[model samples]
Target: MEITRSRDFTAERAWGAKDIANMNGITTRLHWTDQPYRWHVNDGEEVFVVLDGQVEMRYRSPEGERSQLLEVGDIFFASVGTEHIACPIGEARVLVVEKEGSV
Candidate 1:
C-alpha cells in the first residue's frame, strides 16, 4: 500500500500529474495545477475528485453550457463523450481516474 498527501503535491507544468495507479485499463493520477485544462471530450468515463483548494468545473451540454464550483472532497463524474474543462481557482490538487491514455 502507498500513502499520498495530495495537498503537498507540486508540478513544473500546468496540469502536471503524478501517476498513482493503472488497473483494469483505468489510470489513477494526482494532478497539480494553477491554470485551466483545455476543453475536450474524453473517450471514456472520468472520475474527477478535488483533493485540495477549489476548481471551476465547466461543461458543454445540449442545453448549451453549465458549470460548478468544486471544493475539497467534491467528485465530478464525466461520462464518455462529455465535453468539459477544468479551471483551478488558484492552486489546486486533483485526483483523476480515467481510461489509460484518455484526454
Candidate 2:
C-alpha cells in the first residue's frame, strides 16, 4: 500500500514500519485525559508539536529536572535516554513527532 504525507493529525502508519524516504519525523496524537506516555529512546532526535489543547511535559535527569505546559503550536524535544512523562490538561490534544532512530 501507498501512504501520502499529511499535515493534520498523525497519519496512521503500519506498525513497526519505516518510511522509505527520509524519516524527518513521525506524527501521532495523545488523546484527551490520557495516561502518562512512555516512549522509547531513539538514536535520532525527537519532538512533539502541540496541534491542539494543553499538555504538560515533565522530564527528569540526574543532573536536573524540568516541567512545562504546552499549548497549540508548542513544540518539545526529548533528549537521548531521557525518561519523562506527559499529561494533558483540560481536554488536551497533541501531535507527537519522532525522528527515525531518534526518540
Model 2 lDDT, full chain set: 0.57
- lDDT tens digits by residue: candidate 1, 1-103: 9998888889999999999999989999999999999999999999999999999999998998999999999999999999999999999999999999999
Strongest candidate by lDDT: 1
Q: Top TM-score: which candidate number?
A: 1
For candidate 1, the clash count comes to 0
Residue pairs of candidate 1 with colliding backbone atoms: none
lDDT of 2 by residue, 13-84 (tens): 212222334443554433334345553455655676665666788888787777889888898887667777
Q: Which lDDT values do the candidates have, in the order given?
A: 0.96, 0.57
Error of 2 at 101 (Å): 8.1
Worst 10 residues of 1 by lDDT: 1-10
